[model samples]
Target chain A: MSEERTEINSLGEFGLIELLTKNIEIQQASTILGVGDDAAVIDHFGRQTVISTDMLVEGIHFDLMYTPLKHLGYKSVVVNLSDIYAMNATPTQITMSIAFSNRFSVDALNEFYEGVYAACEKYGVDLIGGDTTSSQKGFVISVTAIGEVAPDKFVKRSTAEKGDLLCVSGDLGAAYLGLTLLEREKQIYLESPQLQPDLENQTYIIGRQLKPEARRDIIEFLQEQDIQPTAMMDVSDGLSSEILHICKQSNLGVVLYEEKIPIANETKEMALKFSLDPTAAALSGGEDYELLFTMKQADYDKIVLSEQISVIGYMTDISEGAHILTKGGNKFKLVAQGWNAFQQ
Target chain B: MSEERTEINSLGEFGLIELLTKNIEIQQASTILGVGDDAAVIDHFGRQTVISTDMLVEGIHFDLMYTPLKHLGYKSVVVNLSDIYAMNATPTQITMSIAFSNRFSVDALNEFYEGVYAACEKYGVDLIGGDTTSSQKGFVISVTAIGEVAPDKFVKRSTAEKGDLLCVSGDLGAAYLGLTLLEREKQIYLESPQLQPDLENQTYIIGRQLKPEARRDIIEFLQEQDIQPTAMMDVSDGLSSEILHICKQSNLGVVLYEEKIPIANETKEMALKFSLDPTAAALSGGEDYELLFTMKQADYDKIVLSEQISVIGYMTDISEGAHILTKGGNKFKLVAQGWNAFQQ
Candidate 1:
């Protein structure tokens, strides 16, 4: 009680991390890199090592009212694996740690792990080690994934370049819209228990929110095409926030085309039904888990035709500012309003 | 409720992990090892990789009634670094994730991270990445530690040979005794609200329980002496259980000396006060976080003697059985009563 207490909000998450790590001394000669990338890179046994971790808590990250445990398990793995892919590394191993309240019967945990197993199998990642303990309340899952890449082959978010072609894989904003639909349905169901909800047409958008996939295939495709992204990151915090990250880190600006933005047909339809703008959803909706990267124009011919890949925007000098070319060809300044769990 | 339900208890933790990992395929050639050992081993550009993870849940692992948030933070990192040291690797990078209930004020979290920062500075590890989110109840901390070692220098638990000398670093059972004392005090305080429990003389044991240190120093000492352990593991799950792990994995048996089992004077006194046997406490009491290992007998002369390192036993042929030689010259079988959190 004698110790002075300080508010975590004062330090924030990033500030706390920096304060904790500021005095750490790297003593190992083999620790080529540590604590500063999408993944912790270790130089060991002549290979470049990559490690990443993510944790998700119930209510904070998901609501079980509409979220299935199986999808939650799959998404947990996908989110963590996304960090490995962000480093341009191939994930090979993962350790899952979970804490569950007694309210969850043993059967529920089995169902959760079933989905986790499916994800591991689908991604070709080994479920290596983990710990399970009793939580005081709702379920919590933490996954740490280890990956590998050629020493020089790994891409970092800090390497974005001026005039690089900014690209994104697959469509975006569906997950956010999907989440909104689920929340509204839950509210309506609560108000009138006997009302039958309409969900047949919203499956595609809902599926994106409930079960997201890491862009591991995109990593493989890039390798096959012999093209390396100059800088890359996963679109977990929306396109606007992710682009801002690259721009800030790479010291450049970006120009995105609103008309060229890839929004799935289902997503657009749902946006209209909800009276929401597809562009707004694409810009601000999070948890897409898609890849956003920058590459040289020369390599465009190799990847442009790929079905899973999309060219959403390009990078420019810092003075150019981040702009979205509207469908009418007018320039609009881009802004980032990504989800920050800490912000009230 | 209509979904088919299966129980997780039927498949235990290890079984569940096995089931989940059965179909996983490693896609990266640089991943030298995964899903086993203390941490996943990746082949980096220059050195060998080491990684390990540990999860601590409130109520199951610790009681916030007597546990300071700062100590909990420090202990979490120590538990993880201990595993890295068990592999004879250098602790370098760590990612920490936590879930806290709203009952915990933001000030409490800042205090917790301050302790984490202190330990990070003491251990020379960087806080690279992590996630923080709201917990429905209680607190959960998950830490993943990454270290590095030379390919040839990395120690494993499956290499002990016959006649190998079994060694342990530091005294044992103090942490367990500390828990017993704290529990008694807690019960007493619960019975009488006005009671003030005296713990002036219990500092050593209580500190062991509250702030356990990882044996990274032993690793440095061994390297300085150029003595490589044939087999090694951290004594996190009691001395007997850890020894059994090495024996089972290495296909060997052990003959332990009762008198050689190191116990601190304070720990012995506390056990006697609590009407418990000190030696028994040292054998099966968990959470000591000390190093227990075996080395070839011929290498003993190369390593200098230190008070911290005690020769407790010798490995023998599997047929010999794991036996403890008492001062009375009677042989007794060793049993591992390892802690299982899932058990009632």
Candidate 2:
């Protein structure tokens, strides 16, 4: 890698944007326009368009000390794409707008865009259009993802019915545990500059926090199996909070079992080592970009063959309320202690 | 109007979002889903979807001290929508993602949302989806606008031909003058807290900068008159820069007349007061939010009757080069002194 640092002012905003996006080839047929215009045009002639946006602020959503610019760029795109996937739609295009302060160089921006392009290639989504501007402070990234779905095929968070099976893709609590490990390491390094961080054992958790992928595979798997979720949402704000959201929006109650919740062995070990309950971390810890959804009982056999999924619980009548049944047979109301940006 | 400040943490991000978007009624039939979902769904059916995004960073794009939060919100939406209109499309939906620090209260957010809703209602566009997060410093807004256009009807900046008549909608340079006035007043107020701003006569220019509108009417008028532009773009980065963009993309040259460039009396007076050339201001001063387009020479009589339209100049052969004819009959190459976000 080159250590060249080019001032962004040399090429200017337009020049930089052109250089970054010049090599992008449109993969989606829906994308009629991509870059080099005031706006991009797409033709979703026979399908419905699903759109979602997410804004990631530096020092709030990421720490520059630990997070690489490329990873940040990739994660930002993934987060928004995750929402589109949660809609049970295939993401086709994304417009990413970013504002960075003078502290960053053109090379740094290039690296970030490299990550963005990598994600675009991996997901088969076109980079349509975006705005690049200078910020007065830290980096700000906003990505809007557009997906397409067949008519009446899109899933919603409010369409779950009673007796629906609650399911989640991938393991929980890993990203949150990863964050904890990184924070601890950061604190140690800050206190003692000579200290060498021992993170070899925490690779999985750290990676989960640093570069979590959206569950596009899960959506594809569901499609391959001919299964449509009655209600769905990405487990961004933790399993507990997202489940609560499904229950609240669907006007029903849920019963999630602790033992049934999928937790990676490494994540569980890390949680216990940190004197934190694994179940609590999985329930309340956020940033695990997995899919949480509910499907009718008729689709259970179709999904049961998949090893990447877990049947956590089931939806019940509204009067039953939202609660979790522990391995010890204790039933308690689920509380949303998810990551709140406003919490001090 | 009430002097109430509510901490956003009390209601949480979800609660605040619900409160702000609760009253946003869906006006566009294409909007299949609006808010309360992982992603909003739109069915443009046969029409091509036009998408554009813009990111506004505080202290870079706006100064919150003089720019009201409401106006800022409205302007942010308008800026993105303007890009969609520049493509000769009908804006159907917008997703606005915002990042704000702890200094802002829930009331402040509500005020911003009030402006957002106002724009949505006025434009008859749906507020579909967005992400609201905590900023480390000042406010950051990113808005993605989605519009629909009939097949092959959407205009581009790169399709102008030789002999096309260059046209502009509304007057130019007022917004730049407005910004100058506000900045001067801000400096005076900072130096002497006791002095009141003497802005009694600069209302038009001030309002132009504070609340610029996208030329949706111009699009409608063009549609009604059955005139399709050869090329089009919003006059965002000044007339000279936008014209240069059109010329560069279309692989043609232009001959813009100095005397024909529309300038408002208020703008001229303000520019003169600041010891600036009015023509120069009209050429390079940006943020006008007006339409700059080129149409076939055959459509001249159709647009000539419009009071709001101005025939600025005409497109020329590539060998002619892009140049502006001065009022004194001297021709000079058009230089792009557009707002470069990266310039120190």
Candidate 3:
């Protein structure tokens, strides 16, 4: 963002696309072709390809009032990459398409692509083919991540067997609480433009929301340790919602121990400040981008090798039903309180 | 066309996705997993995978007043498939993500998916994965089509040699004329609500704009004839612009004959009604979704087997420059009047 603004129409569609993609450095050997083609070509060398897609709309998904363009770009790619990692696949390439209103400028998109390239560089994925178009209103982004996995090795939610140790990588609920804080700060700023946003130096929680990373380390560690989860999924939805999906899809019940759920100190502190239950946030707050998985009990010793991993519960027979044993010694039926964007 | 309407929020995001995707019967042998997972899986069976993406925004790329939801759905998929086919590949799967405001009902989405499935059935591509979310404004669709090509057989736009025969498949400019007609009708309807719309029975042009098909037949025909194109791309941004791209990318020049550019009889009639030159319309009016390619002169004999293809030009040395020999025997330097959505 500079004082001088160059209109998008000045460069036209082809010129703008060339400007945006000109700096892309392809990193994947699987990416036989990257950008500047009708379609990108990939040769996975006999590996099964895994693909996932995600769409984000401004105002509905993010308020640009506080979100930086670069972080927005990074998070967009990271979210789709999380889905690929959840499938136990190595992301190799991505196609990103964006539609923006006249409000966006070339410089604005340049800053955004700076973040996109940063993520691509860090994650070692190639920026492949995409579409650039104009929108009638706010900015919209759609990203598709492509990955590869060894044949028959890709994890699925429907394969968690009974007695498997339910686990998760990294902390949960920070991103949701971070969003709550940002929204509050946004409201305050709208009412008092002169006043500065009091983020309370909650950098950890805020960073979780603005620049969350896909749990690539967990996947890599698993690969290094030869510990394959029977079932796994990324927690874009809340942990409770994701747990319900594994249970429903696998036709197995699960007993989640609320006491064992991992929450960072900052997340817990922020929850208490907001008068929200930390456990509740951990269960129902979404967009953590952490990996939730179930592994065989025999691998428990190996799983503990990573200090980031937490054993949350165990899968049970379907007859037992999905439930959560609360820290207060109360057993409650688990329900999917996943954040629904369509909620009225 | 249901008497009862179900609100999208009533079903929630997951429920809506389930309803839309529940009927998908996988049609591709490469699609190992479709929907109901974090990501979809595909195995290209040693063939190189081709991927392309497109995003269409309502009011920007399409007008809902004249475009049926079903046709919009079908066109969205077809446009992406066209990119894949441009690479000389057989499309196998697609991921469709859409964001729509609450102004739409669940039944409306059902109709859109109806057309999506129709295209999938016709193209024999599996609908694998997608993201459905709420938009703050109009409908936005993002589709990524995946295809497979025989190893080292996928085509590129930068491989045309001098003296290669430049060709195009199917007719062009009809879609642009059709859009012009629709816009005028919309303007009339907007200005006078009492007036009944008169389409003038321009079915062919209208259909080209509303539900254009990808040139899958041309690709199939080429494969059957073993006629590999030297340079190739889909005619998306008008013939003049596409030809310029071919020349610039291939580092060669082209001499196009305006008389050889195929314009359907209906297209010519519509252009005349609009008081526009038919050849100019064929050169500058886009959204044809037709194949534009350069083939070896040796393959020229096999190319005529399909009545759909027409030899429009020949590749030339760079020193010859890119020009069009007009019907009146005037040679003009080719300029791209490609449709620019970002135009002020």
What tens-digit string does per-residue lDDT give for candidate 3 at A186-270? 9998999999999999999999999999999999999988999999988877899889889987999998888899999999999
lDDT of each: 0.82, 0.80, 0.81
Q: What is the lDDT of candidate 2?
A: 0.80
Cα lDDT tens digits, model 1, B115-163, are 8877888998877667776677788899988887887788888899999
Evaluated at residue B291, the lDDT of candidate 3 is 94
Better of 1 and 2 by TM-score: 1
Per-residue lDDT tens digits for candidate 1, residues A117-147, read: 7888888887766777767778889999878
Candidate 1 — which residues are off by over 4 angstroms? A1-37, A45-47, A104-107, A188-197, A224-226, A297-304, A316-321, A328-333, A338-344, B1-36, B103-107, B188-197, B300-304, B328-331, B338-344
Report DockQ per prediction, comma-separated. Answer: 0.46, 0.18, 0.16
Highest lDDT: give the candidate number. 1
lDDT of 3: 0.81
- Which portions of model 3 show Cα errors greater than 4 Å? A1-45, A338-344, B1-46, B338-344
Clashing pairs in 2: none
Q: Indicate whether candidate 1 or candidate 3 has the larger DockQ.
A: 1
Each prediction's TM-score against the native? 0.88, 0.86, 0.86
